[model samples]
Target: MKHPYTKLLANIIAYAASIILYALNAGGSINGLTILSITLATIASINLVRAITTITERKQQ
Candidate 1:
């Protein structure tokens, strides 16, 4: 789908997957790589949300 919602959903799912993996791999304590991956994933999700919001706003105009 070309709709912004698609991007939003995909981003959310990807972020969730990364979070789950981090939790699984670094049970009690988080490792450096895990932290890095999670940080990158969160940034990616935020970017996706921003892009989607821009798309919706453009469509509205």
Candidate 2:
């Protein structure tokens, strides 16, 4: 089955992977890429929460 938010889920996964990679590469240092990845991850997390809320609302109807 496919979910309406499949694309968003994929994007979130990609963002998470990049965040991990940036952290590993930085080796305890903060850089532009690390900051950017973190920002994106935060945005993606918000989107995911919205998506989950939408799904729950639909189920209640």
lDDT of 1: 0.77
Give the alpha carbon lDDT tens digit for every residue of 1-61 in model 1. Answer: 4864876687698767879676777686777777787778777877877887888799899
Q: After superposition, how far is residue 57 of candidate 2 from its true place, in Å?
A: 0.8
Runs in model 2 deviating more than 4 A are: 1-25
lDDT (0 to 1) per candidate: 0.77, 0.77
Q: What is the TM-score of each candidate against the true structure?
A: 0.62, 0.53
The residue pairs found clashing in candidate 2 are none
Question: 1-61, model 2: which lDDT tens digit per residue?
Answer: 5666778777777877777776978677877777786877788698776979688779979
Count of backbone clashes, every candidate in sequence: 0, 0
RMSD for all candidates, in order, please. 4.1, 4.8
